[model samples]
Target chain A: MSPEKVQGGLEPSETVAIVGASLAGGACITRLRELGFTGRIQAIDCDPFAPYDRPPLSKRFLAQNTEIETPRWWSPDCEVIRARAVAFDAQRRALRLRDTSGAERNISADAVVIATGAQPRRLPIEPDGVFALRTAGDALALRHAVDAGAKHVAVIGAGVLGTEIASSLRQQDLQVSMVDAASLPLVRLLGRGMGARAIDWMKEWNVDLHLGVRIESIRCDHGVCAVTLGSGVAIESDLIISAVGARPAVDWLINSGLAIRDGVLCDASGSALSMGHNVVPRVYVAGDVASVECPNGSFARDESWTGAKQQGVKVAETMYYGAQQTVQPEPPYFWTEQFGRRVQILGRVSENGAVSCVKSVPDRNGGLFKVAESGAHVAWIAINAPSLFAQVKAGLLP
Target chain B: MKVALDAKRCQGHARCAAFAPETFVFDDEGFSRVREGFENVKPELQEKVRRACTNCPEGAITISG
Candidate 1:
């Protein structure tokens, strides 16, 4: 395994600055050390607290106040900088950081990794006191709101995060109402069959359904919040949470000389691409901020938790070992815990593929497999059946 | 070397089982556990187990000497 470094790759003594102490950034730092890279890692964390796991923020963290401390691996051989990366100088491999006190400074490194992840998208008519879950502080604020006698909650957007937030709030005995423009929740990702099933689950959970409707306006007046729909009907709640979706946190890299469509475009190895010029010197993008070029010659930004973690590892391997490893990209996978059931999706589901229920139990514990005409399993969605999902994901299902 | 899977922490991301299928077993709900006999770790399987431990999002796997 002793191989020369790729052209322009970082040396063991070089320092790497990771902007955004996100899952991808965290994973990259850990994997680099595991790969025997002795480079100094600067972890730039924007959060007030140290880097902590975010998945629980919408799950157990809000529902039960479980404390998720920073992982033990982040402390050793790494400098934790509590600052936000304001700008990136790709040409000079430098970053402009703005600390909590509004102080700004420029620090340079041999290699730069952008793992800023994404921020929750707000509604056009978002009023004051609207809640959006992205960080630990945001989760705490929501929990505080609930603790402060928040009974009825209106959640906008029925996407994964929104749905999970709704489920979590419901677990607290809060009356939750969900509003989305799509006719069905997760219709784009799960398609009609599985999406319909999702609707059924939400309905069964007693979440006030406001699907297939446009939110005209949101107003919080006199201690009551009203979400007005396009049909002139309004659903009143004590609080409103805007979870329409999220946009990649690539605003800082706008002038970084890297190509940006939806996100910072990168090659399969996570190397940031610069149009009409040689690739930006050792500047890589991973996690939600990276729009990675896939084997099929298409660019995709995988915003899921698993995708971010895998990309973190892959980018670290490329940065340290010089991209020689021809590892196959792991299939895209994400799971949502809603209504106390774990719904997981693995692999790509072709738009026109046939989706059939391979095995289903009355308790909503089963697998839904998607396949093209070639008879190969293209995608699988398992509800409350993790073991079976793992088997089918490992190609055990013939 | 020995490894332990914290049942409380495992939210069933299943990256452990994916990385080291022989060493990690999945429960019905998709959470992972270090296989019974393999918790002690074999010499050849140590690397895979390490990878699994690192890849786990939940950080449920613990490796100790």
Candidate 2:
């Protein structure tokens, strides 16, 4: 859903207040109108510019400083609130806002969609040249450093985000060293062998790899920076990137008095599941701020673009169709183009290094590994080959 | 008796995944994705499943033997 679509959902909505004016919020608004929702639609975004894509902040946006070529990922024109959300009143169905002037306005509505997204996790030690890759503002800050051709960047995590950042930095000729506490670059999810392959790729690119180590503290002085490891090794760096992880953007809801565990907990239907299943009729949460409950009653906090968009659509469906229609969890998939390899994984991957078989595509120098016991096909990961990925994904659907 | 997750809680935390990965692979979110031979699982494998339950960070698994 884009900005143009959201403006259309306005006619049907008696009064719709989307607390988040970003991607998910923008998409929800567009989708609602697209589905024939006609009512008052209000989108509140903390950032001045209307919603844009964030994934690029780590890759293309960093590699190339060009604005979106065409699809803005938003409608042509939507009322972007450019205001920060301060609080929420579930009973009154109003959202508190502090505009650029610092004036407070309690905006009320029939449907309140909370889409306040997560911010980057900052390190406690605070190295002078340290940075994060979350918001566009953060990207701009890092972009200057990259454009300035700052050499020798130390990426603090081996996760996808960190790896991508490292790759982008490397493309700019900055010597990058990716250090992680995990045994492998992607140890928490992909097993050690997969991690080894990641290391192999990084090594091929000459990005220094420091696996199975902990950074005790980071210190910076003037233009130089250094990080001390638990092993008593000092790594000198020009820039330090803390790409550890992210927590929920649940501060406003925390004082709002709604049920929150990690994030605003919602049931399978996207409704605020107060006290676990006695659904509140009007309130809803979507995106990084919401904890979606699977059909089995266990909740998981997701901070991915796909999860946010999928849940945003689901929330709209639940509102229009009603809660009885259950939406099963879709297959979780994410991909990254990094270090001269496009790495993609579908289905679940074991961290303990389990491999049923690795089928190689001799032509492309890639292989597809079948995760055993995963039914007909659990997941298929491909490196540098997308055709094989498609074949496996299409065949995996039960 | 041994317990298994309902495929939802099994977000590959893999705490319980160490048991018999050949028997318990995961869904994209890292949960117990496949339903395998809980009945025919070897004794040691069953015990591994029990340990997975203990290590699960989200407390998404439980086992009895």
Candidate 3:
């Protein structure tokens, strides 16, 4: 559909209520305004601060000792509501929200966007020294704890966020130890060989690696945490950062009657999919909270920064025009910075897929690896070689 | 209209090239660059090009007459 066709049927006076005013929510409202949707836009987020970029939380914001300034994204024209969306009444097209002051109200809208992102998964045991990074405030608090003489740090989980946090803490001259249930860090995404290579980098950075172990219990005393692993080893550290994973923040939608599995179930076009294979009209899902079913009958949730933003744009277009006008699905792209190297991956890299080095750089620990399934190229991984990644990406295009 | 890409702000998201491959191409470093001789998009393809600019998460693309 053409840009003008986006606003074809919708009236400018229509109200669009968006929950979770983070990256995805911000992108949706911005795209709507840019497309000449002169409707009343209400952005509701539990965060008291305005919408800001999140990528910095794990990197620059965590390492820096000084105050880190948040970069705002919402425009002044949008109404920013600092409140928690408690429930959604789809039949009435209304949302129940509770403000920080403990006041509750119901606001009706012509359409609703469920951009409520994911929250960090907590361990079975809750202790004072355990922390998870998901927001600007979390980063600030972690940094403060480190600055206040947190010498030994133990990071649970070896995923992108966990490893990145370990790298940042190591940069701050703290002793770092990493524990993960997986055999190797990122093995599920990068495959075994590449994951092993990443482990080598972690070891070189002096991070104590405790793989294939689960934290049985955590005991905190006098601001120090003693994490006991399944192997019966107790690691004493001043702070514990749990980068285990995240679950879609869909507790509020439990009674809302939305079909949720892993996340809010949606079709490829970002329209909420009900249990009976019917579209939940006037309600859209995006960001980490959305699990989109692909044409291949598989469901995938892209929690990356780029994925959330693209999903936001698609959801906006679908809401404005129709699902028939949805943009074409692009290959999944993800990047992470850890151990002073930038790792980029395009396409899906299955655990059992065969991988081969497509290109290499001299004297640099970087190369392009092509992952294939039964001789068909399915994904590409580039380590510290952005130029090669660009070349491979161009070759993937038709 | 002339389409320009702000390379400094791009963090290799590559949405521009993903959406409008004919008009935008990624350089060696994975950053976006307008395809050769396609700096000024044709009137017929302007809408598609505009979608690419609109979808960029970094807001690094600009279209001008």
Candidate 4:
């Protein structure tokens, strides 16, 4: 039987402190209001310009310097505060916040949603012409470098971000050379075959690839940048972009007693867990910062945009209706645009799953390949096949 | 209820259609557009339409009654 609901679900007058006002935090606020929550909401975030779309940062925004629009749901009712979360007091349901002026304050709430998200992992070497894209500011800075006539760009890391940046740079007619320690692009994330396909596509787009090598040094002298590989191969460029992935922004929660492995550990219902693995009541986690419990008892962070939004909604539901009524998560999905093609990944794509079929959509000039196991669709990868993807995804996901 | 989609803001995530196909449709290039008749939404479709609005990653959809 389903466990009893927490006696006295959240009242309309209760206050909820959401620490992070980006995609996940914004979504949580939207859902709370949709559920008729009239409570006081404190949307805390370090970014003065929070709640903006992030996917375009490396794509259209970096290439054409497109405007990163703020979410429509970011209304005045949420009471957004421009502050960085410094610490959490789980027992008291309180938070310590530091604003831009270094002023510190504490606020207690009936519930707290930790959605601090993640930050780009910086490289060991620091140089003037090097950059990493994560926020709107980062993208603008990178675009400024491009506009200032930085022709050749050396991208370090062949993961999704790296490849996407390379594609965007190529769209702007800038020469791009990519380096990754892995043998192919997205090797760890998408497996070997998909990685090979990505590398091939990048090559087709005229992006120089230096794979299966370690970076010995990245030096920027005066104006020119140089990247030296472990294989004695060296690449010269005017700029360097380190797309080395990101880590959860969980430093502030270190002393909060929350479980912190790769991210803040949370139960299936989005309730955060203490280091001893006990649920911390009224304390929740969402977005890239939440490492939610899985079937095998392992905690994993859903870092994708869709996953983050879903978690945000779930967290809101749990906060309003109580954890007993929290909905199970939907399938994982993410999309990317590169080399004039839109690629979408639905569900899980594993190399172990056999490739069931590859079909082409003649009308859209697109194609999709499916991965299945035991007559069930494990995942589907679609390239410029949104309609087909929609049908398959609709049928597969609830 | 009326739903409006900012064409400039829609990056073709196609989530609106996925959530409420009756209220939203996609263009040839996969960008989302509010279904023509959806300007005045039927009472029964309001919940789903609002769901689509809330779930949109780009927050391109807005609803007014």
Q: Per-residue error at A235 for model 4, in Å? A: 1.2
Q: After best superposition, candidate 1 residue A360: deviation in angstroms?
A: 1.2
Model 1 clashing residue pairs (backbone) = none
Writing each residue's lDDT as its tens digit, candidate 4 over A1-398 gives 33444654578779999999987888888888877789899999888668787888888887776787766545557888898989998888889989899999999999999999999897877566678988888888888888999999999998889988999999999999999887878754565666667776888899999988988889988658999988788899998889988999999998998889999999988899998999998888999999999989888988898888888888888888785463645678888888877888877776555554477875654587776756787777888876667666556432
Better of 3 and 4 by lDDT: 4
TM-scores, chain B, all models: 0.94, 0.61, 0.91, 0.94
Error of 2 at A263 (Å): 1.3
Model 4: per-residue Cα lDDT at residue A265: 94
Candidates 1 and 2, the one with greater TM-score: 1
Interface DockQ per candidate = 0.55, 0.02, 0.30, 0.41
> Could you list the CA RMSD of all candidates, in the order they appear?
2.2, 14.3, 3.4, 2.9
- Give the winner by DockQ: 1
| Residue range A196-261, candidate 2, lDDT tens digits | 777877888899888889788898776588878999988888778889977778787756657888
lDDT of each: 0.82, 0.68, 0.82, 0.83
lDDT score for residue A85 of model 3: 94
Q: What value does the lDDT take at residue A318 in candidate 3?
A: 80
For candidate 4, what is the lDDT?
0.83
**Once superposed on the true structure, which residue ranges of model 2 sit more than 4 Å away at CA?**
A1-13, A68-73, A127-129, A275-277, A322-329, A356-358, A362-365, A373-377, A396-398, B1-65
Find the 10 residues in a row with the least total lDDT in model 4 chain A. A1-10
Candidate 1 chain A lowest-lDDT run of ten: A365-374
Return the lDDT, model 4, position B20.
94
